[model samples]
Target: MTTRARNVISAAIVAGLLLPAAPALAQSDEQQRIRKLEAEVSALQRRVFPGGDGRYFEPEIGGTSQGTTVTAGTPSTTALTDILARLDAMEASLQTLTGQVEVNANTLQGLTTRMAALEQSGAAPTLASAPTPTPTPAASSPSQASTTTANNLTAMTGGASSQPARPAPAASGPSSQRLAAVQAIAKPKTDDAGDDEYSYGFRLWDAGYYPEAQQQLTLFVEQYPDHWRATYGRNLLGRAYLDDGKAREAAPWFLNNYQADRNAARSPDSLLYLAESMIALRDTDRACIALAEFGETYPAVAAGRLQSQYEANRAKVTCTN
Candidate 1:
């Protein structure tokens, strides 16, 4: 009885000891597996996230994370879509800007070509380099004080007027009115040697500026009745009217010029323009009369070329009378 009881008691104690060891061993294995998994996850984050800010975690605070961490490996399709949309918008803007740049380039090229053509055509002389003039002598007995004053002025200027350019008087475009004003001031002065009526007018209306030319020419003719260049002035006036798209106004002007200077070389030219205007007005009979008159008056002139052209054109014109 004693031996049997002793063996049973030993067996029971050993079983109890084995049961406690099994639980502890299992806990140790679980802890080791968790450490290995943690290390692997840290290595993966360093490779994939780059300082924990690849659209995910940010820097760590003292004890706990500041913002809620989104679960890793979840595809943020919304953020990627937003980035693609912004890129598309930028591309579209770039295309529009490129189109505008091309249009501007074409406009600039056209402007440059036109400017070059205008420059090549002879224009008014540039005012940049004025000629140096010789000094003028004063009357005899010119005192030293007077000479000094003159020299001082000469030193101040290179013998040119430094007076402020008189502001051009305002006008509502150069019309007959402006011509009238100048004619009033310059009429009796026409006989004066210093009078520069014709030249003044020419300067104002130069470069084929027809309307301005006509206004200046009118002033010159109004001021001087039988002056040497009076007929020349009238001829220019007619040509100016033609350039200004005033054919009817120009017709009488040419006739007046031709009548005033019958022997002038410009007589045939004035007659030709007059005929052209008459034809434009549908007065073919008068135009032919003018043409015949020009042919008889000046048979050999540069303007005679216009007469032949007119005859050829008349062949096609429908005559009213």
Candidate 2:
């Protein structure tokens, strides 16, 4: 054969072989793409429906007219829309929760601020004076007599009596002498000085030296907070203020003593006194609440010496049943 003729025939044979291979390569590429798409869809299905009972797209929407042939790279638009809607709903819910948290934080902040003010001032603001209610003289317990006298004194002082801002009745010679003796008595030097210190304050209170008793008991409680007598001292401190005609200033101390330990030795007494202070402040509602709490919390104690005191105070106000 001639060279040009042989070259032409060789080129034709090569063309035939290459053309067949081109179709085979195209078919293989298409199969690889389909397999990749199927793998991606399987992963998405596993993630969206881990239990495998549910799939992202409905079976009716599969890309087959005659059989269950699923088309590669095709997803249900409605499923995508539902997922987006769910995401939007979750965002809205998160925003609502965040707003509630902020509101709670603000409320907590307000409470903290009020507590700080109460601590700094050592009392709440004095309320306006109202007509002081008097307890009838039916129950003549010694405790009741003493408390009635105190109420009369408070009403007189708060209404129009020419008392100083703080009462200092220790000016009389007998009171002065008693106070001097009390001052001379040294605090007991022992691991437990609580008893002696509390007794000293009690003596001052009994002797009508309320200011001195307040100072002494305040120091005692601060020094011996864990001591058994601290409860007594704290309650007595409030009583000193109450007897001094400063019921508003005394109420917080009484409340603190009762709330510090409701089962403590003097906690029941403190609750009674807290109610008394409330009555003096003309807050009959809170006074009744304090009285109710006392009766409920210490039923046994309320039936004892406190019965007369409770009845006397209960007579002072009309509480709702």
lDDT of each: 0.55, 0.67
lDDT of 1: 0.55
* lDDT tens per residue, model 2, 201-288: 7767766777787878887788887765666677888889999998976776776676566666667787788889889989887787
Best by lDDT: 2
**lDDT tens string, model 1, 25-85?**
9977866676676567656756765656545332332222342333444254754675689
- lDDT score for residue 142 of model 1: 40
300 Cα displacement, candidate 1 (Å): 1.9
Tell me how many clashing residue pairs each candidate has.
Answer: 0, 0
Which regions of candidate 1 deviate over 4 angstroms? 1-196, 302-321
Best TM-score goes to which candidate? 2
TM-score of each: 0.36, 0.44
RMSD of 1: 21.0
What's the residue-level lDDT of 113 in candidate 1?
Answer: 74
Alpha carbon deviation, residue 190, candidate 2 (Å): 6.5
Residue pairs whose backbone atoms clash in candidate 1: none
